[model samples]
Structure formats: C-alpha cells, structure tokens
Target: MHLYYEVSGNGKPVVLLHSGGADLRDWTYVVPFLANHYQVVAFDGRGAGNSPSPTEPANYVADLLALLDHLEIGQAAIVGHSMGGRIATDFALEHPDRVSELVVVGPALSGFNFSQEFQEWMQRINAAFPDIDKVIERSFDAPSYRIIKSSPHWELMIDMFRHHLKKTTEWGTFESVWPEPPAIDRLGDMQVRTMLLIGDEELPDNIRTAECFRDIPDFQSITIPGADHMVTLTHPNELCRHMIRFLGG
Candidate 1:
C-alpha cells in the first residue's frame, strides 16, 4: 500500500515517524520547526491515518525504503518515536547506504534487555484483569502524558490515547509478518550519525536504554529533564534544540 505522506521545506530530507497509535499529525508542531531548514517528511504508517492496510503483512522498514524511492530521495536523516523509532533503527541497519543520520526518542528495541524490575512489573500488570477504561488511564501514566494531563492539550491527548489503545486491541502488536532482528547487537554496525533521546521522567527501563548504547563508538544520548515518552508533543521546542544541534553539527 502507498502510505500517506507529506513533504515540506527545501533542504536535506528529515523524515518523522510517529508512534504506533499516532498518525502523521503527531508531528504537527515538530514539522514546521524542522521545515524551516530541512525538507521534512512525515507519513502515516500502514493502517494509521489515511493509509490503508497492505494486502499482505507490513514490513515497515521496507515500506520506508519504498517511500524514499517513490520520492526519489537518495538519503535522509530519520527521526522516529516509540515504535516508529524501532523502524528507523531497523532501516538504518538494513540499508545503511540510504540513511545519513538516525535519531530515536523513547524507542523500543526489538531485543533490548529490560531490567528484572521492569519485566516483573510488566508481568504483574499484564496478569491483572483487563479493563478498557483503566487501560486508557494507564496510558496517561507515561511521563510525557502525565505532565500534560492537566494542560490545555489534555483532552485532545486523552482522545488520541484512547484511539491508539483501542486500535492495538483490534490489531494486536502488528508483528506477525515482518519481524526484524534485534538491533542492540548491531549497534556496532551503524555507520551514520546516531543519537538516542530519552526523557528523564520516562519509565526507568527507557532511561536505562541510553546506558546500553553508551559503549558504542559515536553513539550519543541525551536525557530531557521535563520530558517523557511523548517528548515531541510535550517538549517540541526542547526536542528541536537537540535536533538542531545534532543535525547542524
């Protein structure tokens, strides 16, 4: 399927990948900030926004490569959040020649090791009886959303959160067809400029992911004090600051 995408500005390509529940619109604030200096590309992944589901299984990394081909872009710097970050990492690994730089925010690595504490916590949570409304509430516990829960954007966030969570219930993890390998082991193979961003207030497991990549050559990481999983939405200006510093360097 041809995914829905939009491009803006006129310099190097900067592709934005939204989280699983999000569509292209999640980049609303970040896009303009980037478009001022780069050709920004934001797209709705398969089954999100206006993009229709593929006839077969979805291989997001392949889909991204195809999208670049369709746009006639030889290379791009990828910025992805959560699940989108996982895709960005996989694509950079599989097609190193096609990526110039890669950045991920609160990303979920395919085989990243979760601390025993985190794993047990998740097990406990998953073992409990499921409640749809409670599930939606739990989603807000993510640091970024927690910070924004009382803000002007709170209501809008609630709706978006509920929508995405519901979609997960309907579609499951969407991992049946196009499973990719764990990237932690391949960190040494990344050839492009790479940066990992994590919010200080985010879950402890995500914060620890930075330490996982610190030993790799040329890998850099930053922790945003007042931000969380949805840093792009909660702290776009701060996020842009790091981005401008890295991409412009």
Candidate 2:
C-alpha cells in the first residue's frame, strides 16, 4: 500500500508493472493510449523508482496484491514488461480471480533456464558491481537492448537504469521471493485471459520464454517488428494497439 502509484482515466482497472532496471517511467508512452480507454494504474514497484527500498526479502506478488487492496480494485487487467511480466504471471497463477486478464511484454519466466551466454552476460555486469557506469554500459550492450540504444528515448532509458542501479546499492536485501515450483511449471494452470508481447529483436532466452506460455489455453502472442527488448519505449503505439485489441477495449 505504501508503494508510489499514479492513476489516470476511468473504467475497468488496468495495472501496469514496469520492467526491471527501470521504473513506472517504462510505461510513460503507453499510458496515454491505454488511459483513454480504461482506468490505468502505474506504480513503482518496491525498491524501484520513488518507492522505498525493500527492508527484507522482497515479495513483489504480495506488494501487488496489497496495492489492489489499497485501491479497492477487486479485479484488473495486468500488463507487465520484463521482470514485471514474471510478477504478473505469478500473480495471475496465485490469485486468478483477481486478474481479469494478463499481458506480458518481453517477460522473464520463472524457472526458465537461460542460455549460458545470457548467464555469462549477467555475470559480467555483476562483476562490474559498484561501478555504475560500467554496469549500465554492459547492460545496454545486450542484444535485447540493441534497438533502444538508438531510439530517441535512449537518454531517458539510461537515466532510469542509472537511478535503479544506484538505488540497489542502498537496498537492505537483494532477494525477491516468488511463488513456489516456478511459473514455467504452472503456466498451464493460468486461468486468466493472457497475451504475450515480444520484439522481433529480442534475446533468444526471452523468445524461448514466450514459447513456454504459448500452450496456455487462452494465451496470445505478438512480436513487434523492428522492436527489441525495450518494446515498451520503442514501440509503445504498436504495443498499445495490440493490447487494446486483446483486452477488448
């Protein structure tokens, strides 16, 4: 309930969960489009953006539930990007009745074994550690970020990454608790209407993750041409169009 959040327009609720290494600003371009049709709730997840750093192991799913309870929203269409998508998927799985629909953009799936190359890439970034610039530079070097680096939103993306990295230095704990058995093991059990969005230029691990959700009974998948991992920023208009269609707005 203490998490920072912004609300716009009015209709059935639509909650926006941002990607990791960024904040609610991730939804800046997409909000305007969706807000016109539905009540949009954009929030800074704990330890990201203006939200307070986690004092213990982070419980993102619980934080989301608390946010809904605080807002008195009984059910909502949940839209998430990257790590946010992971949280959204888990939330729908654990609290199906609370999620009217689910949409994941370049999502990370729990229990999906990322390729060794991806793991090494992350390890290299972590090796940079306290050197924020190096970490940021290495992060943007990933294939998934190839498009965003050249987009007009490049500086803003960098700013958010810089801020998030700096804030991590102040966190009490780095652990984020997720539902048991992992989402990969439970995708088939997801009952909420679902959609998966990915950029054509996305990393292989992410593409595979998207495939994992394809078998879900009510799932839909979209690949934004010319987009990369930062589809939210680089292709917000296209993303919103697909989302509105899927959500029936």
lDDT of all the models against the reference?
0.77, 0.93
Q: What tens-digit string does per-residue lDDT give for candidate 1 at 39-94?
A: 99999887677676545567788889999999999999998898888889888888
For candidate 1, the TM-score is 0.87
Clashing pairs in 2: none
Top lDDT model: 2
Off by over 4 Å in 1: 54-56, 115-131, 142-144, 166-173, 176-181
Cα error, candidate 2, residue 141 (Å): 0.7
Q: Which ten residues in a row have the lowest lDDT in candidate 2?
A: 129-138
How many clashes in each candidate?
A: 0, 0
Candidate 2, position 165, lDDT = 84
TM per candidate comes to 0.87, 0.98
How many pairs of residues in model 2 come into backbone collision? 0
